[model samples]
Target: MFKKLFLLILLLGLFNHTSHAQKRIGIYSLSTISSKSGHLFGLDSDYNGLFRAIPAYCVDYFSNNADFITIDRKNFQLIENEREIQKSESFMDGYVVGQGKSEGVDLICQSVFDVDTYSLIIKILDVKAEKVLCSSDKKMDKNLFGIKDLKQQVTGMLLEISSKCFENEIPVVRVLETKGKKARKVLIAAGSNLRLRSGYKIEIYELVNEKIGNKTISRKNTISSGEILKVEDENFSVLEIYEGNEKLLELLNNNTPLFCKPTTN
Candidate 1:
């Protein structure tokens, strides 16, 4: 019927809107400390190659894996061109903010590699807020000695960055129903549409609020952990709790405001 068709169109529109609502991120070309120092000494060929490859790797990874983020490739190229013109790998914070705003991206990722200290520092900036959202500093592991080991170290650091930036994208579902007092299985309000898969771990938690002076702080207190047992449909999945079942059952019995999110691990 026309009514059903209209409803279907509306749902599609909403889904498209939600998909586009994801944050757009631009990654600048990797910078090096030696370049910032303006010294004649330059990084070795291997290090240079590694630095050049990192941004591409990041682009490919996000393009393939992230459903909740859009990569701003056009602006990324522009930024790289500007860097090449400047004949330097380093960019100032002001430049980063200006470029980020001009590109109209929600977030910007910048990395600085120290050739001397073997440290890779990554920073994610919020363009509208004009501030850093998160950052990570990683030093080459002592155990990792060769170029191959260095590549692995850098890859691990990049993965950490990805994890931090996309953390909010993890699907959150509400516990809809519980079997019984000793319930090990529960139904949730999310499934395949959220990219949830069987065996993916989930953590159940409740927000706890505590007052300190005139301020109230809220944090998640994990009550239980589970893994997806089945994806029944696009909007529902079943989980089997393997940890803290008693606490989870008590919370469900009392109808607590508990939420579940897929674990990054």
Candidate 2:
């Protein structure tokens, strides 16, 4: 009888040890993100239920290895039901706006907006990286607009609101802030800060020959499209761009301040 008891206790101890050995690598929260784009940003008391849901999920995710907090599916359903109403009212035409110009040009633009519906839109933006990791609209609603620095903005937000999800109260792990001496020709997105030169910094923007109006605002000299790197130094740079067959260079002339544009929503 004593032998059986000893074995049982040993098994129980092993089970406990196995459970304790499990560690969580991350905490994810999918809350109903109320933003200025959604027009529900600051004008309503609609956050009470959403806030309650966040903490509960954060706690659960913190305690469990593979658990995550998510925006309630029902809440998004309501948004979907209202999308057409917003469209018919012409209320969904929002844009998250900003602007940009070739290195050394003085032309610039203001910020824009985007209409956001209550859809299950996943926007994986990293404010630290200042880039958009994900932007997927699960609905055919007319209320969503794309962002400029979707990444950096997202990171800033997660740090601002979801600091409870990580061990380091730091909201983002900045790759640009940490990088040194291994890049070329930087790319600045519409609406990003670009007073850099020479060496390294995180650059964000979609590298494409996109035309804004009749202005051929792309790397006009034929720079191939690649991920834009961060500016490295303070010297006015004659940076080269290569997108497919177009290889062009823009002098970082003091002709323009860096800028990014918003969506038309």
Candidate 3:
């Protein structure tokens, strides 16, 4: 009886863990075409190469930097090959979603690059939801120096779109250490990787769970706030507390469960 009970408990724990696992993202092959000159046949090799680099860079960026998401590279290759065959024709939304769902990915990242106007449109689709979560349409100067310059622009655009698409998955910045008599300065466990920059405001919060009449309500209560002083590295940053400094210090000293999120203001 005890062995059976232990196995049941272990099974439940595994189920819970699986339920909260990060979403898997698959990047499709970037489609390139000329808006004015008509199709792939009219595009030069340089333009095609530059456009193809977008999806490759996205796959690398998300795989290395996005800790809160998972990338299915094996399936991405399959989808990429299929899309490449259909590059000359327009692919329907239903087909894309179906492919993503069949591959077991939760989200799909797809883009279309117009070679003539140098316009790029990126879209993030939620496979299960069968809808676009967010999208960005950016135009670039055709006179850009070379492929490197175009790559830099594409990376910036992708970062912005990614931030919007996975805003909720942005990892919480934790107070790693503190300084100052009143703890006016703090070191957090996040930096440029979180897209944090000097002068960006961060709101500190403590998650609270309350039980009321057999139901549990969870919410984040803002306990303090700060402005970024410097991004020390990819894994750390310094923040100068501007609000509720004393309370923040108290929480820090007590080692309370605190987390911070970057604010738009």
Candidate 4:
């Protein structure tokens, strides 16, 4: 009787733990062909069946994990119906966030397939923070039969994506040179390799020292701002002073150790 009672108690404990530990996740339909074509194509019955099949695979992958609770098609469809009733715009990010909130999900994951490199890109967003927690790309190559194996290919990829959760944001790039020496334009340390876009506003910060416990800590002082005028190559970008103020130009002339972060509005 004591052994049976102990077993019952253990079962109850496990049930309670699993009930409270789940992190609700919403997986959107996979989008294919990023670099080859700027246009985004969604899942359909006639084409790219593999992309449509990915969401279910994701659900199965996380089913055993006590920390995850993926929103299935039924719940996701309900959210879509409600969105239509509310006449809300269905922009991908906005839609995902709305669905996540409606379903009380903690995170939303988006899958994308790039045709050029045959790579899969996964992006996970923290629903409450309204920010991307992580993004990773994995190449899906064909097997010996010269055919892609969705399950085998994406299993390892999913493992990689899962491991990157809660990672730090992309590191800040630095300013390498000022264009034309004393000119308002500058050269920076990011380019196509980092997937940087042109016309992006950036914040320039200078390294400053602060004393703490007999140790000097480095801090950033916002010195100026600029916009990426051109993407030069894999290693460099061209920036021009966005503010065009003499003070900012003078700061550029001062030539202090500087770093830049992409400006967010």
Candidate 5:
């Protein structure tokens, strides 16, 4: 009997280690300026009240140029574009290996005033590999003049100029700590073993109360997403779940504590 118990504990520990290794997550935001809008420069009037924002290409070209615009020769001008600068440096390096242009994240952006829209693009090249990492479409928001006593067109132009200055938004990660009280719904899915419907409800309890404290909250799921709604309460040693409204009940899964209804709702 003693030997059997020892072996069981060892096997359980190994299974847990493997389970954590398979989780997948990779989401990121690329760009957020009006870099893609075609409408540049706006107008100011009394009756209908209006002004067009800067043209989209101008925004795109300007953003690529690092927000700098200088007069060119007698006829045209030069846009110190962000992507253009990157491209020129690559050609000069003689190390670019891509078939043609490099690739990077692609994204889009929009502003508040325009009913019409713009499309712009940016591609960043890695110095060592000389390959594009990502790209995006960006939009701008002209919200200041709409609300406060301020200049909307000037605000928009300033925004465009600012957009031209930055390469990309810095990436940040936020870690959330959770408890059962705040938990809206629970999903109990274990491959072919467990199944649940959208509106089904259940109670959640803490398996390891010491670590979780007492923050376990609950909600009623007025909606469901079929298979994903089922949670797998591995900690409970059984299959159970709780329901929540659609707006509140997003993808609920994992070892969510399931309580006997009378004890909870």
Candidate 6:
């Protein structure tokens, strides 16, 4: 009986250890661009509001996944205050990464909004490496014309970058085409170039707007998973459906906000 009790305690400790291992991500205040001039502008009251709201948006998007821990807003504000004292030039990615590391975060992220072009750009920096991990530029669709809509779109884009930051092993692949009439198979953007091979399973997620608490959060929901059937040239591969049904095929065909995450067998 004592042995069983000790084993239970050991298992609980292991769970707590693993749970705390999630990467910590820090978000800096957003920078903006002049729509007509296409040049960066100084941060104003408008930019400050956007920056303050980003943390909440980020936390909402990543809530379901325990793989990320966002830096506290007050701590992030303190970093911003320190940056002002240093009075360094703007867009200094290295400084941002350094500050993030000092604050015990593994990654740092920033967003730029182009008011004129109505585009959102998000950049993720590896704090330890002090280099860009990934950057994404997304334009607001007609459906996202409203301010609320635009913010949601930007949140989704940022979440994508954040999710990829922790997944060092999994390369993101795009769906190129759905083969056959049933669309149970898909051609992906990764192949030998990404060192992919057959018999590897991949999870696919669809971006959706979910109402969580009082906010409308944009997040990725796992819709289907598949296995690599063949790795063609350097840039393409075919995947067969190991899980999911016709609904997954339809989502892929519709050009939904979908991304593939590869897994090791």
**Predicted structure 6: clash tally:** 1
Candidate 4: tens digits of C-alpha lDDT, residues 56-93 = 66766666455788666522442323322322222455
Candidate number with the higher lDDT (1 or 2): 1
Model 1 weakest lDDT span, ten residues long: 37-46
| lDDT values for all models | 0.65, 0.29, 0.67, 0.62, 0.28, 0.63
Cα lDDT over the full model 6: 0.63
Better of 3 and 5 by TM-score: 3
lDDT of 2 by residue, 240-264 (tens): 2223211112222322222221111
lDDT of 3: 0.67
Q: If both were scored by TM-score, which would come out higher, candidate 4 or candidate 6?
A: 6
User: Which stretches of model 2 miss by more than 4 angstroms?
Assistant: 1-75, 82-146, 164-167, 171-265
TM-score of each predicted structure versus truth: 0.53, 0.22, 0.52, 0.48, 0.20, 0.53
True-structure lDDT of candidate 1: 0.65
Badly placed stretches (over 4 Å) of model 1 are 1-24, 27-69, 74-95, 109-124, 134-180, 232-235
Give the TM-score comparing model 3 with the true structure, all chains together.
0.52
The residue pairs that clash in candidate 3, if any, are: none
lDDT, candidate 5, residue 216? 62
Among residues 3 or more apart in sequence or in different chains, the pairs in candidate 1 whose N, CA or C atoms overlap within 3 Å are none
Q: Residues 140-257, candidate 3: write the lDDT tens digits.
A: 6445564434554565566557657764323334454555636677777767664567777777777789899999987778888878798998878888888888788887678787
Q: Report residue 205 deviation for candidate 6 (angstroms).
A: 9.0
Candidate 2 positional error at 219, Å: 42
